[model samples]
Target chain A: MDLDLDAATLDFRGEVRGWLAEHVPRPGLPSMDTAEGFAAHREWEATLARARLSVVTWPREYTGREASLVQWLVFEEEYYAAGAPGRVSQNGIFMLAPTLFAHGTAEQRDRILPAMARGEQVWAQAWSEPEAGSDIAALRSRAERTDGGWLLSGQKTWSSRAAFADRAFGLFRSDPSSSRHHGLTYFMIDLRADGVTVRPIPQLDGEPGFAEIFLDEVFVPDADVIGEPGNGWRVAMTTANNERGLSLRSPGRFLAAADRLVDLWRQRGEPEWAAERVADAWIGARAYQLYTYGTATRLAEGGQLGPESSVNKLYWSHLDLGLHETALDLLGADGELAGPWTDGYLFALAGPIYGGTDQIQRNTIAERLLGLPREAR
Target chain B: MRFTPSPEQRQFAASLHDLLSGADTPGAVRAWAEGRPEPGLKLWRDLADLGVTALRVPEECDGLGAGLTDLVIAFEVLGYHAVPGPLAESVAVAPALLGDGERLRALAAGRLLATVALPPHVPYALDADVAGLVLLVENGAVYRGEPETEPVRSVDAARRLFRVAGTGGALGATDGSAFEAGVLAVAAELLGAGQRLLDEAAAYARQRHQYGRPIGSYQALKHLLADVVTRLELARPLVHGAAVTATARDVSAAKAAAGEAAYLAARAALQVHGAIGYTAEHHLGLWLTRVRALTGAWGGGAYHRARVLAGA
Candidate 1:
């Protein structure tokens, strides 16, 4: 239980820290949501990929160091502590890439991963639609088999980065007769194709962070199909689990936010009321960090990811909200002003709503983890 | 760097669970709370035989030379059962404060129950009347003490505190180890109690029907308990991490998190149990009140959060 990193792990941490201290941008690039910010973040990803730092845990053949999970956590801590650029390729690296490793064809990994890692190609998740937000299996997107591929047509809303991303992945009903999860096929579609139209949506902070991706008979090669036809639900679960769990949201981000909050409070005279909140922010992040450490340990011991990922999602989503709220309160009059804390507060508002709402996570935990009676949905 | 408990630690917890399951701990707690410690005393001896008390004592002291991590495993089980007595004092603080003297030997053998009064932090000795040994800790100075007045009643009946007056010169210096151990023990206990409360609440939600369905099926209640589960889940690792490090900051972090988490669990459990949980006869109150009592037993949220800030 001791936090005794071995010599090798310590050396790895030191190397990452040194690299980040040296290569991280002087002033971090803008958020990867707007056009200018998006291009700048993509360039930053190129810088990281050139150094094999863009995807630390990915296989070395795909522009990564093949770092261990523990090292990846260390990399994250150092990365956030340095105030590095936002991961412009996170949709690809964190979400789709894991699914690719788990279910993609060997050729798919070889073709997609390097470009994704290098930011030459960026990916957007087209998981949600107007009617199939949380109930993703109720998607109406359809794919028709073609000579060497499939023709995809769907209106996918809340497709992050789709406005600028080169490609997107989602589930489309392949068999017209099948309803719900049965007939769906996971397919990667080119956002720049002939019939694809992206409508950028302004988020709360008024940034084009999310977009509605409309595909009208968009062409997707058979090579892009993941798993098998009628198996998109299970394949997407691989991505869904990664999105909600340790991969998408690391403890480092919260730890960094908590540290900044503490600094903000101290700079603001540390009001007695907000003092406890400030301290709790730090404690909450530390607990989550320690909790992740436990998760990493279990994964190292040959344990597979289980329903506990929902636990991670539930814990961090609220911690993020509460931490940002405290920071805003510390800002007082300035809280209403548009700044980092305000922006973060707005962004944190969606933590519980995205990556499977905390409500759904609760259902998963109750039924899957606790063995409670399933809800009569 | 591994954070999961060892297999042996897991086995130890299971064994303790088995013993406590059969011990009818709710009855023991009820007896102890009513100022009758006989059943609780028997439970204590049984735990002692299982090496709970001897975990911290040195090998030379005729005890298992185990670490705070091991003590945390034992204390968590003890807390899950809500076992009564001066546990933090006898099992954690005493061995860390005292040398392997007659008193330490007696504690390791479960023949003596100790209570401590560390002024400013722990101003009143819990269960001082029932304990066989009472010590006052002022600054770094330690001394044998006696109760200056009758038992001071707590909201939780088992917590019978007493103001103690030192009877002799400082017996020894506290050396700070005892306080850390005590705080760690209480943190683990709170985590265990929180887990039990969540478990009971979930079970009740499953069986107790309302509006033509089990209450557990309601998203409202499920989300409520889900949040509780997350807190307890995260809090346990903090307790374990504190046990691993034993730093002032780490211990206080554990205490603050576990204290708040367990308190939240108690509130949610009460909410889930509804009216029946409010009754004196319902065993849920035992854990509910115990959580309330132990929240400030070593250091409350405000105090521990302050420590966390100061330490950071």
Candidate 2:
């Protein structure tokens, strides 16, 4: 297998490198979890959209370059390497946009994608309820048929970015008799609709990084339904796979972190105790990058992602946690204080718990990929 | 850039796998351990006839003229079969060290067998009794030697290790690439061994019943095997990527990752097999011991980690 980027990819890299160098916000935008920071990040996203750099792999009509997946990876590498601000609209642009392109009707795409790309409408995932964190199919959220739309009634907890997001998309049981992945309808709901409430939840770093969304008979127009009604389970799997796969946690972020880790180790006089761990972190990141390139190649060759996404999710979760843990270990006593390392460590702790808990991911890997028997439900 | 193996490479691996599946590799491994090397050597010749021995040798030397990536694919299949030989030395390292020589031609043609002792890290020669040639590498210099040897028992019975004494005239000066190739070969082998362990354990878990159901249904067993699967899957790309790059740092990184992943798989496999895996009669023990032996074969995890950190 060849590791060298083609001339076209190299040229794309140069273009993205040049553009990001010039337009990436200096001093970086503030963390997007806070309300003010959210507004600033949204503005930054608008600037990116204006420059047609918000979604490099999407169609040009959606403010993208229609770039190849390899070029998109290159763009991510340059973006993270430049120390750019995190995407405030990632939940929309990365997770939802792909699902929309794949399953949304043409009208839905026209109405939602460009706005999402421009950061005019930020999205949050509303899949997990208080009782349905990992076993999401056990969710009791219901969307009942109404005259012109459906009335959504449910509670969705751990809805990341929901506190500031304009809308949310999730699965609701549309058929009263259905249970466990059956007869669910995927709907996009306006957070500002009547009978909806969003309560910001303080995370480990004391930021409102997630929120609890309560829908009490919130009316959603039929136009907002993604894919056919009563087939939400199949439709939502695309978004879940995206969440756990390459689109959400690109290897660029980890590679950038690894570089920073090496720099930290060098600055700390290369402490003997931390050296192996530092090397391991770097190696893991490199392995992930190569694996992702392989995956991108496979997808480009028309392969579909399946249970293998669970493997990726399990890997990056641990890699992220380990990288941050090593950074803290190098920081020593100062790591106890509030800093980027400490903040990142706190965030990394959430990796294994979100998108699907590690336990659930393990089960998926075993039952699906390995052809093992399913455990008792 | 393509990261997965090409279709041609996959076909080669599949062919090798078919041959090994029918080769009675376990019997050959046992025969070798019992000091009957003829059976194992016969299988090795069969592999050589498949051009496994000639992969990394240059075309000028009457060899296949393939790259390290091809050697990695061959070595991984050999590891999966637990093939009993100094495969890394004969197939990968010796070609890099003895490039274009008559001895290289003989080695590639399967007319000779070679074993190496690279000092500091690899102070012992493996299968020197069966080898037609023995080489010593010290401080970047290669020397032809018929050094005195003292037997050292290995955890893997299929492997016969010995400490060498006395060095002969210098053959040539070489860079670190040969050593790095050796490391990458071992990493590939470790990846294969880990994959085998995962496969065996997964199959066993599917059939072995406990608590009135297959053990595979238990989360404990499922999670254990799943962890191994993830480690092996992630480590594989590193092995292939290292073969592509063949730099010291890349090779060392591959070795470190493959070694750890394989060791973890061994542990998980034994755990999943329960008492049966501990018995000598089971083929699982053969792979278990082989993985243990290979984990520190070229260089242990700590050494590879230091190499990676040193940016070598």
Candidate 3:
């Protein structure tokens, strides 16, 4: 097992490092959840797209450089290490992009991918409804087949970035007779559609981080339907896996935070009581980095991600929470104030709740990874 | 870069697993604790023949000249089967310490056995009665010694500990890297032990029923075992990664993580197995005790944490 970057990866890393060094904002942009900050992050994404750094792993046809997974990870490391702004287009770039690449038709890829890569049409997930959170298959959203398209009616809550996003992608029950997983249709709907309503939901940090999307007979063309009409469940699984895996949360983010945490600790004269906790945060981040490297290596070697994605989700969620918690603890009384650490801590708290809750993740790990008996439904 | 083991490394571990699986390791462990070292020695010789003892030794020293990653793989299997020996010393530590010495060749060839005492934490040599050589490490120096043995009982019966009292000629200055190697090897063992506990607990959870359902179906036990599995799986990358990047900080981080993971697994295993697991008759107790002893073996969590913090 080797950890050293190969020559090509090193070259890619050098290129990314050089580009980020030159282009990363001198003073970092404000929180991407804020309206002004969202615009700034969108501009940053445009800047990255111009350099073909926005979606390094996508094919050149999609305005990308067709980088390898290792290269993408290296790019992410460099991106975070450079203190670059958070990706305002992450819901599009990370969540929907992979699903589009995997299941989208040629026309869909041609239309949606470039817009996503260029940050021209930011996307948000419209998966969870008010009635359906963890049990997404129990969603009551319906998509009635009309003449050449489907008329959708649903209320999706906790739709991240939906407040300002141009489009959303989610599953809608296409057949009235079918329930649970079958007869569901995955659709990419315009948030500005005739019957669409977007209501921003203020997050714990008092920002419109996510929104509630109300779709009342919103028409989506058949071409916007991803995968097969009755195969949305299968299609959505790809997005779900990506959400829990490398796409949404890269180890680079935590490693950078851990580095910041260590710096904070050092600044505090290295209090002996907090030393182990600080050390643990760093070690945990390193473990995650190595673990992601392992996962990337496995994926590169043609291994499919299964329930192990749940394991990755649980690990990173806790790691992020713990890293930020330690940072705040090191901050002492000042931690109570609204600063980077406190803000980050608030965001970290959302990690376990989103992408799927820790409880759901644990259940998945137990049932799928450990071969435990599923509870009686 | 490939962070996972190569096929050959996996095959090596698999073969070791097969051999240990058939060796009646629990019986051997019992015999060792009963002061009958023959069975454990025979098992150790079998492992030695597999070139486990020779892995870290240089090829010029009549050994495999393998890296720490290979030793990590071998040591993991040894821990999985709960193999009884000074494995870290003979397979990892002593090889790095002694290098191409005449005794090193014998040790690699399974002709001789060795134990070590790196005071003040490890002032006692384990299985010293069966060892043909003993090395005492102190203050960056290594010395040959014949210990005046006072038997010290460990929580794990298989570990025959001894307090050494002797002085001898210095062999050479001890390399700090040897200690780090030892820690990494022990970490691998802890990872293995943790895995075994998880496996045993999972199996028991499936079979053992309570309140009209299998205990595994209960969310409490399920979450507990799941957490154990998560910790073990995460600790694995740390151990293997530390093997590749053998820095003091990396090794210490690995040791700390592996130790805590193993300790968690031990606790969870016992809790899942209930009263049966606490009894010595049950094989789960073997790993439980082994995990406890090994958690504080090379350097405890506090020591490794301090090392990581200092290095950070």
Relative to the true interface, what fraction of contacts does candidate 3 keep? 0.78
Query: Taking the tens digit of each residue's C-alpha lDDT, what string does model 1 give over B265-296?
Result: 99999999999999998999999999999998
Candidate 1: regions farther than 4 A off: none
| Candidate 1 C-alpha lDDT tens digits along A310-358 | 9999889999999999988888788899877887788889999999998
CA displacement after TM-score superposition, residue B43 of candidate 1 (Å)? 0.8
Q: After superposition, how far is residue A346 of candidate 3 from its true place, in Å?
A: 0.7
Candidate 2 is graded, for docking, as medium
DockQ score, prediction 1: 0.77
Candidate 2 — which residues are off by over 4 angstroms? none
Stretch of 10 with least lDDT, candidate 3 chain B: B142-151
Position B207, candidate 2: lDDT = 98
Indicate the residue-level lDDT of A107 in model 3. 95
Query: What C-alpha lDDT values do all the predictions have?
Result: 0.89, 0.89, 0.89
Computed on C-alpha atoms, the DockQ of candidate 3 is 0.84
Best by DockQ: 3
What digit string (tens of lDDT, one per residue) describes model 2 on residues B1-312?
888899999999999999999989999999998778998999889988888888888888888989888888888899899999888888888888885479878988888888898988888888888888888888888887564555688999889987776366788877978888888889999898888988999999999998799999999998998898888888998899988988888888899999999999999999999999999999999899999999888989889899888882
lDDT for each residue of candidate 2 in A10-95, tens digit (9 for 90 to 100): 99889878988898887777779988999999998898889888998989888888998888988899889988888989889878
DockQ order of candidates, best first? 3, 2, 1
